[model samples]
Target: MAIDRATAALLGGALGDALGMPTQLLTPEEIDRTYGFVDRFVAPSDDHPVSRGLPAGAITDDTEQTLLLGRVLLESGAVFDHRRWVDALVSWEREVKARGSYDLLGPSTKRALDAINAGASPEDAGRGGDTNGAAMRIAPVGIVMPFEPLEALVAKVAETCSATHNTPIAIATASAVAAAVSCGVAGGNWREAVDCAEHAALRGANLGDGSARADVARLIRDARDLVRGRPEAEAIPLIVERIGTGVAAAESVPAAFAVLELAAGDPWRAAVVGANLGGDTDTIGAIAAGMAGACAGMASLPAGRIAELKGLDVEAVRLLAAELVAARFDRPDGRVAA
Candidate 1:
């Protein structure tokens, strides 16, 4: 049987994160030179201090922050508690800092959290930022809020994103990702899912300066036109070049969507293609992987690749995901009951 929606999100996010870890910083050419198209998970290099040359299966901030969001949501039950969300983020930062590790906190997130600690309102902490940090952590919200009305879900995502990515583009991008994942779970087609995300993003974009929105919108249009009847290899670079893969929400989110559009039914291939594209590989992999995982379910990911993800609370994530699905579907005793 296919994995449940929640388990699919957890495993999808974690596996994508772990797969992209080794190739995170390498340029596409360097990746080509070193690994010649990364088809399987590989160990980190000896020079890399993070994993100490550990074999494949090492997850990064993508999965870590995703789990943090899951934990917060599960604990908060059905309510969208802003203070609890802020507290959870701050508490996680403190705990990570105490351990002398900055593993889970993105640069933008760290800056926003620091500003929050230094007296900026949590709502204002990410005022000018526009990074993929918020988008990377958005999968759980999609899982939790799948059945809600689209506007309600978008509003909650914006609220969640405000803590560390309040810029219009960042908020829009994060909401789009969450909305796409949620739509996928609801059995939307690839085109329908992308359209739902585009709609959510356009709504957020309209509320701000709108330049980033225009850019992503144009890229999505162009990507759709370009990928018709083309192989993923022919289409990936065109979209990435036109849309970009930088950590900016505008750049990364659309590139992910393009890859998803091109590789609609194959989550593993889509993620691998995104990861090897270089330039924000992890974020690309995370975004694309989340969508594909939701659409295709966890079984779509290869058994070998799933075996390679490292350093995550796998069982906990699975349990939380199952609980979230249960809650959404009105099961007798999901995590909300406990």
Candidate 2:
């Protein structure tokens, strides 16, 4: 039997995160030189900024923040109070700082936290960078809000993201990814979920923090067109050169979607494409592979790879998925889920 979509999505993201961890910041040239192809989960060979010295199969901030969002939703009964999220993140960062961890947090998060510490309101703290930090770990938002109307979902997304990535592109890209996950969890096919996501992206791109430079709508359009029928090898280089795979939501999110489209929703394949793309490998892999896993169903990932993922068992993820689904259905407008 297939694993539940929720379990699959979380585990798939964790798998991609671990697979791409070692190669996170390496140049495509360096990735080729160092590991050729990252086939299994491994720790960073060199100090790769965000995740140095992490054990093999250890997750990065991508999944950590994703879980944090989930925790907030569950604890708060599905009500999205931004201040609660702010407090939770402050505590999370405090712990991260206490651990003396490296490569664990992004620049945008660091800056936002600093501003908040300096007394900036939570609403205004996250207006600096427009990176994919918000998108990388936003799956939980989708999991919890799958049934909310699109406008409502988008509003929640805006609230969730504005704390650290209050830009149009970032929120839209993150919403698209989350919407895709929601559609998948609801039994939409990969194409169906992508379609849902594209629509959300269109609506989201129309609004923003007014400082973004990249036209996310155009980038996604070109990205989808560029790899519509291309193979992975051909798509990887082209995407790297044209679409890029860095911290920008416009770049990484679209790149992940293109890889998913090209790979036909194979979680592992999509992840490999993103991981091999060079920059922001972990985030790319996390988003693309997680979406692919959800849309393609749990069995879409390889059994071998699933077995190799550590610290994130399928059963545990499945249990959480059940809780989230129940919580989603349990909630009423502006009320906590049962």
Best by lDDT: 2
Q: How far is 70's C-alpha from truth in model 2 (Å)?
A: 0.7
Error of 1 at 74 (Å): 2.4
TM-scores for candidates 1 onward, in order = 0.88, 0.92
Would you give me the overall lDDT of model 2? 0.78
Screening candidate 2 with a backbone cut-off below 3 angstroms (N, C-alpha, C), the clashing residue pairs are 50-103
Q: In model 2, what is the error at residue 320, expressed in angstroms?
A: 2.1
Candidate 1 lDDT tens digits, 1-338: 11365577667767667777777766777777766788678776666434345467677778878888877777776556668888888898887777555754677898988998899888777776788898898988777665346666777677677778777787778878887777777776556777777777766665432244444555566666766678867776776677777777777777777777777646777778777877777778877878878777766767677765667666777788776666555532212323
TM value for model 1: 0.88
Q: How many clashes show up per model?
A: 4, 1
Candidate 1: lDDT of 27? Answer: 70
Error of 2 at 75 (Å): 2.1
